[model samples]
Target: MIYTELYITEEPSEAMNYHHEVRQVQSASKKKILHETPIRSQDIFKTLPDQQRPIRVVLTYGVAGVGKTFLVQKFTLDWAEGLENQDISAVILLSFRELNLVRNQQYSLLELLIFFHPTLHRVTAEKLIVCKLLFILDGLDESRFLLDFTNSKLVSDVTQKSTISELLSNLIEGNLLPSALIWITSRPAAVHQIAPTCLDRMTEVRGFTDAQKEEYFRRRFRNKELSSRIISHLKTSRSLYIMCGIPVYCWITATVLEHMLTTEESAELPKTLTDMYSHFLLVQTKKKQKYHEGQEMRRIELTRTDREVLLKLGRLAFEHLQKKNILFYQEDLEQCGLDVTEASVYSGVCTEIFKRESVIFQKPVYCFVHLSIQEFLAAIYMFHCYTNRKTEVLQEFFTEDDKGNKISLEDISSLEDFLSRAVEEYLLIPNSHLELFVRFLNGLSMKSNQRLLGGLLGQTESSPEIIQRVINKLKVISCQGKCPDRCINILHCLLENNDLSVLQEMQDFLKSDNKSETELSGIQCSALAYILQMSEEVLDELDLAKYKTSEDGRWRLVPAIVNFRKARLHDVFVFGGSIGSLAIALTANPSHLTELHLSSVSLGEYAEDLFTHLGHPNCRLETLRSVN
Candidate 1:
């Protein structure tokens, strides 16, 4: 067993910490990911410096591609090599994706362990009781079983036979393996499957810190100058830098940048997220054709077969993305007109790229190398639908028919409205889940990106007037007070369109003498919040009322309060759904806030949690003034 360490942090067990660590469903901005506390991987099972209880049944979660599985692998390998956690006699690692295969089968806890780990076949139930076992169940989000923690039949004995869910429930709840240490890994959305009372500690894997992000690029390229240029260019685009916190995004960026710079195509380097992913797709395809097929590469071109094959994969990406299902089956591939065996050809971007992007597990389960790559491909397919006018597909997506046929975007008003409805139309949809997809969809509208994917997208209209209309529609939606997830994504959409006018306008308003005369829009408030959160210079004061803006604008600025020393939110109120961002601000580590004035403001249902922050470990508020 070989192992290597990664620079990472284990967030505090408090729900507030998890809330801030994973601010939205996708992830908090890169600024917040860097603000967390760093804890080594081996120390995850040990109690924190501030804690008293022995850590057991740890629920560690992070967003997709944040490297939760990699950390688990490293921890297990280190244990096997006798370098860490010597007290534990054995480690049993299982993935929920593998567990999904046997979801319908019944087995005793002992049999389950033996099935996954054949060496455990000789171990009896009595032996299990004596061994210090650490059961690491990975990828709870990918599990297909209904994890009913409340009513599942509890089995105290490891030999007792039961359904997989029941056995899992009892083991996780400490009924079956009371002496065993349980470690469950999941995406943040699925952590709710285990109630708060069922776990001892909750730690979030908050991706790479700033230094590690730089370390990744430097390690990738032998040339120091190339690495420096890559880092410098990433810093120029806030969106790219923020996304680079994820290791997978960093790799994708490196792949795109290395090829462009080395090929003397530095002038054609990608700046936006859409541009990067598009070039990534084409570049990977070009490499596979040249190296794997023994073809001479002279020009970057998407042949008709290449277009058909990539779109099939893209369609698969889009359909499954709607369900938030990362793993797929053979049937899923065939349904999209994709040939299973033929998919291995274009292994660079997907299907078989180093067997990383399109992964086939021990079973028939398949998935993209990363969630964002799946999203990028999905966006391409959806954009193809728009360009080709696939009404039947769009109709299926716009409404739910009894037939269960899913579709794509409809009406195709301004792409923002179309994209806006993509998030809001499905009321049951979690807005954050669709953010990356929508961002990619909007990014595809860029002229530069369109040129790159022109073959697939087929030369869509890219006029400045068309872009302004989309930008204006986004502002109207932001002002109408959409959910913070959707609103922030709207601002991201503007950034994807290269619409920096609002950001510049906010900067001008901030520097103006008669600021009271200048009124900021909701989108501008969002831009302001983003700037303040990412700024190196902390503001001495953040008084929302002083800014001339609508109620939605005020709501958008609440997230930036953590970046200021004194916050005056007098007569202000946070919307119910948006209040979580405020909670995050108050509890952010290295807190700058010393005084918070909420005079005449009402937190209402959230008042209890907000007030409880006064004693939280990260809360540094010294003065709090509020009426009613």
Candidate 2:
């Protein structure tokens, strides 16, 4: 709940669904935020002095957990306290999760306001028309109503009765409340629902900047030493550092690290995402057990009833995650055998994994602390299902058509095939919501994580043979995959399994004089590309022809040259189409190549084909050597 300022910009992000964005944003941890204009919460409803019309409807989009909801809440609080937006007479902030529950109900606009806020019951319809009101509708991504802008009935009267969907659509379209300000928040996937013609401005919320991340821990903890230790530990791992952009992730890190630093336990500090989350889960459970059950537990232990609730919650997480449904209802809870009054719903100390939103209505709403937690729980449940021999649950899931491909759950008896197929299924789609979940799944397969959650996960084993198979399957998938995103994900899976063989071989090949002993595979070249791009140091020379790989494998290494000062591409093919690896590097914003040594490589069929990037503003090429 420590509110820090997020990087809000005028330029909207082009990310897909939430988890697809979670994976993609790591690439930007090293790049500059390409926002054309930065804005504050107060500036969202303001019109510029460029002789433009008044900005009425503002559609704000951001990735999940980027602090969109918190920003709006703070904005409302500021307005209520007369600190900002003093001109506005009233600000009514309604949660979309709560609103989604009553999507089918019919109500007058005034009645709708009174339903959510009973204090507004005294304010008559006569007082509403004269006052300047700002209606902040949060979480359009979780909305259930299909807003038919073209077909929904228009209701201009605030007293007129209509479905909630029509009332919102009409209000946004300016038929109901032309003078009132409308502010809506949505994830990138649902931003297209509100057309450009209806919106006057668009804003995107980015996660914590590098400076803001440090400031957050300092603000959260009074002890400077504790904050410094936490920050130092996070910087050691690239994944942990990049993921700190999300405010919730920052909280998760604070919870796990602070517990370890302060406690008397001699557990090793977590280095991976799975390790952090696994420790986090156990920590929360231990606190709950010790407080509620009256006995302090050791390193890691879960009671029988605790394991039952976890598996039930995991089932809920698994079921909704596949449907991309973050928000859950009372029925969702009951379906998973979770009673509203049960100890599992004990909101006192165990709210991190699952909790409910405030509602005086008959129906109760539920959600995990974050999408990542939901994904973590979902991964645990899926693994549980596999280990418990609940093939029916997984079979029902894999039969559906995902994105464009039909995913078949056949011949996946082995642990390697089971995980590889899941990764392959998600990779076929442009934006895989399961990207983070699959990463968790791979990480949970490790002996360390399995030992922590053994009671709940049944008896899933990761023998040396199984681990090698998973690693081998990941490398093979990377070579066959067409999308660079998928190939990068394959590498991530390798990292999750604690297998650094590909990277070690690449380093070995670099150091060895007799490099002919072993040739780098296409996936290994891709892995080398990842290592080069992520490295803090710059390379002086990169000779693609020196490393022995196939023709396609040579192109796979093109992204690595972005770090090189002098790149030697002798007899290399730089062309368009799916083999657009050179295009990927040359168009790189921070390309640092000062000299090029392409002795016999093709520049392209035309000057503007691929070599035109040499004239780009970001390009720093000063020397060219082509003896051919």
Candidate 3:
């Protein structure tokens, strides 16, 4: 009965754009659509009100574009509107992608809380900790980076290890704050590390059912006189219907059909998704013609080759959008083996064809006003980017290693160079490869080996500089910037000795005029905290607990705790000594335990004793983990 009206976007302007479109839809629908199926989520929604169960966490997963967000919004809005009492304090809907800018920052959680509840006080924040708020976090996979937080930076000798699973464990187990009814939505790959214990229920968004899809199609054609020829074509298009289960794809298909029908061109109906989109773009271009002569002349001049180039560029741009890359590069185009000179001719054709239908970046990057168009372009690319010829090109870009015939370092370096070049060229096409390149960067960063970071940083000796470069590159890719732990670990490699000067540099950088200062500062602080905890010596000088608290007073490390608990440690030692010694020292004098990370400390062998001691009624330890 209620539709949550939160429109997720990068900026306020974008949000306004989505808001306007949604408003138009609302105005068109005078009555609610009939409830075709029983509300499957009602039972789940009801549990949120059960004080005894105290439903603090719920996870909903669905295929992309299946309307998971829509359902969640609808449920939350309905609940809010129906409330007779104000006991349901607030309903906050957050898109993880939008919060990425503050990722890995000390006050990120605080920033998010304030962004949603500007009037919330420190006391209210604490009270809400136990289940007073309904927080819906959508699109976890959209986050820019995956972080591991159990590692230490103070010591130069061994690497620190952490995982997302560990972090979730700590949050639920620590019971440091009151829990809230939290809902998370993600694609399957995003929740691989989610602890089973943290989840109360899981729902999959299966897109529109067959009946819904039929109803949707019927609604579009109810008033229009349909030709038997088109109806027959539609009846045969099973794959098209399946794809159209997603609303955006349905819109694209409908637009294509409408154009074909108006032009009396039923014979030209597309048989495949790519052809459908191609036809759509071509028709869209023709609609802008001032006269028949101009339209005919332009259509005659634009060859299939030109269309291919435009479609390829569109696909690359779509990838960039997916990766959240905002910057386009010239080399990205070249990597596709598309000559700039030829691409320029195609660009000219697209300009004449689409006219005001699309927006062209200053440097020739063509961007569709609707993201659906980009999605259409990407679908086309996936169908064609890999061919026998392209496969050969990839092979030529790499050399086999002598050991096990694996890809050599030289080959990896070459691939990176090739990707970089491709990214540069794609950028020149005006918003072309920006999104695709960003996705590439995200995939590269998510690699387990850290080789990508090393390559990106090059030989830079300055740890802060390296971190800054990584952050800057990530921003270019439009990553959510939520994973500070990875950046902190990278910093550890460069700052082996707990160098005070490096710490000072990090502090100075945080204060400087950088876009990612907040996120970098968070990463630096976490790294510092990790180091201090690892080396009992440094923990004595600084107050680590202060950094853990934001001005708003909400806990900053809930997510971090979840991550620390899911990590695996091999031959790992905590505090350079046995777990008992470290615990005794930390509990004996709290000030001396500024940083306390015991992740992967073989704690299972002494779990009962450690928990008995660390979990004691009078324990003074602020932070300690058995696995990261």
Clashes of each: 4, 0, 51
Local accuracy of candidate 1 as per-residue lDDT tens digits, 281-343: 767766656453534333347667777877888888889878778887777788999777774
Candidate 2 residue 532 Cα shift, in angstroms, is 5.8
1 versus 2: better lDDT goes to? 2
Highest TM-score scorer? 1
Query: Which portions of model 1 miss their true places by more than 4 Å?
Result: 1-37, 48-52, 290-300, 343-362, 399-410, 413-430, 570-573, 577-579, 587-594, 599-624
TM-score of each: 0.86, 0.81, 0.44
Off by over 4 Å in 2: 1-15, 33-35, 49-51, 122-127, 291-299, 347-349, 400-410, 478-482, 504-520, 528-628
Residues 190-290 of candidate 3: C-alpha lDDT, one tens digit per residue: 55444555565555554555555556666767654553344456657543555555665566677767766665452456654435555556555554345
What is the Cα-based lDDT of residue 400 in candidate 2?
42
Residue-by-residue lDDT tens digits, candidate 2, 399-455: 544345555555567789778877876665545688888888899898888887767
Q: Model-by-model lDDT, in order?
A: 0.71, 0.75, 0.40
Q: After superposition, how far is residue 222 of candidate 1 from its true place, in Å?
A: 1.4
The numbered model that scores best in lDDT is 2
Give the candidates in order of lDDT, highest first: 2, 1, 3
RMSD from true fold, candidate 3 = 22.8
Q: Which consecutive 10 residues in model 2 have the weakest lDDT in total?
A: 10-19
